[model samples]
Target: MGKIIRWISWLSIDVVLGAVAGMLFFSKLFHVALPWQPYVLLGMAVWCIYNLDHLLDAQKVGEKLSGRRQFHHQARVPVLIVIGILGLLGLVGGFWWFGWGLELQWTFLLGGLIGGIRFLVLKFGKGWMKEFSIALFYVIGISWLPFLRSNSLDWSAWHGLFFLLYLLLANLNLLILSFLDQEEDQLAGFFSVSQELNTVSLILWIKYLMYGLLILLILVLVIIPSFYKLFVAILFLMTLCHWYVFNMDGVDSEKKRIGMEWAFFLPVLLIFLK
Candidate 1:
């Protein structure tokens, strides 16, 4: 079961599932009834993007690789093929289902442009903004339909707080992964934001992130309306799980990565809570 879960994480299936869970949770909170199309599109897009990133890393890294990188290195062709198919489906099906509204147009335009720029940057440029960009994109992708269906372009304080909580959780997950994988990335000649920080500094940053997230979670619990507080609490639990995994000693990076990956799925509980 452990190996099976690791394979699911390595293949990025867990990420896609977590996105779906997030979408459902946010949609329920906003009273938006999202159809099947957005879920499918988001799932495909996330899987494609993650697999492409892994595939690129696999090709770029040196012979010494982490287990995840080595898996990507060995399965590069098959993963690329899957990414290609899913990418095409997401593009075509998105247009067909979303229609040609101004919002849809701008969303796709910005998503495509940013996604392209991000790929190029990851492939060749520095990693300063990589974690944050990925986090923002993930939150936007999961919440786009909810925002639209809610039909309120104007964000209330509660809405903004909820969005910030999700973004903070996502970035914390990435930062933890980056910190844990720093040595492996260094050994593989891979570039990550961690490369810019010493071990002490990175640990300090992770600690600060956890404290910030905890503060945000508290604000959210107090400020968000009662209807959404349950969802926020679930997110808070997810954040704590990541923090615990990051602080664990004598654990391998792969296990920590898997723990973080699984933590994101905790929001699925919101569906039942609703």
Candidate 2:
């Protein structure tokens, strides 16, 4: 069961699942319910890009199969080959389906650019910059729909507010994941913003930021009570995930990562909602 979970995680199926969830969130918020088929290509694109990131990082590891390095030992070559072909196909298919509109095109291109740029910054940037840069990359990657569709942000509507909320959640997700890997990152000589602060300070920062976002979300719910169920579902998941993070002694890091991934997988739960 553990190996199966590892395979699913390493193969980036969770990423595909997260992509669909993100797409659904966008569709629901924007009132633009695009067909589900496009997400397959988008998810594949994400898998490819992530694999490339994995491959690059693997180069820095020793012969040991520690951390994410173990994924390479399982199946490196075939995965990269598939990632290459599918990544290109996903890009082409996306352009063909979503059009070459200025906004959508910029979002697509900028997303890829950010993915690559992150590595360079991580390798060379100051420790203080790591968290903000990481947050920016995820926000751009997961919440690009607003930038893709709008001439300017429309915060008066729920869509814009939801987009910002996604960014905040994305930041929290990355921080929690990094917090789990602080030891591995330090041993590997990698730069993570969490490295700049003591564990308690970092955790406090994350907790305070999340509370602020949660308050804003609750306010949004008050404004649009029709979405009360959705926001409440989110609130529940956020609370659950935070519990796991705040009590890591009772739960292992791997389990915490899975719990957090479920947050990204939250939109999948909407199918069963009333």
* Alpha-carbon deviation at 56 in model 1, angstroms: 0.4
Q: Residue 190 deviation, candidate 1, in Å?
A: 2.5
**Which residue pairs collide in model 1, if any?**
none
RMSD of candidate 1 to the truth, in angstroms, is 2.2
* lDDT (10s digit) by residue, model 2, range 135-248: 566555655663455444433455555656776777777777778877777777767766687788877877887777667666766767575458555644764566556566
lDDT of 1 by residue, 1-274 (tens): 9989889989999999999989987888677888888888888988888888888888888346777878999888888888888888877897788778876887878788887977787787767577888888889888878887785654567777788889988888888888888888777766687777878887888889898888778886896677777987898899899888887899988888888888888878866777
lDDT of each: 0.83, 0.67
The candidate maximizing lDDT is 1
The local distance difference test score of model 1 is: 0.83
RMSD of each: 2.2, 3.2
Model 1 / residue 134 / CA error / Å: 1.3
TM accuracy, model 1: 0.91
Candidate 1 runs further than 4 Å off:
116-126, 153-155
lDDT measured at residue 106 in model 2 versus the true structure, 0 to 100: 78
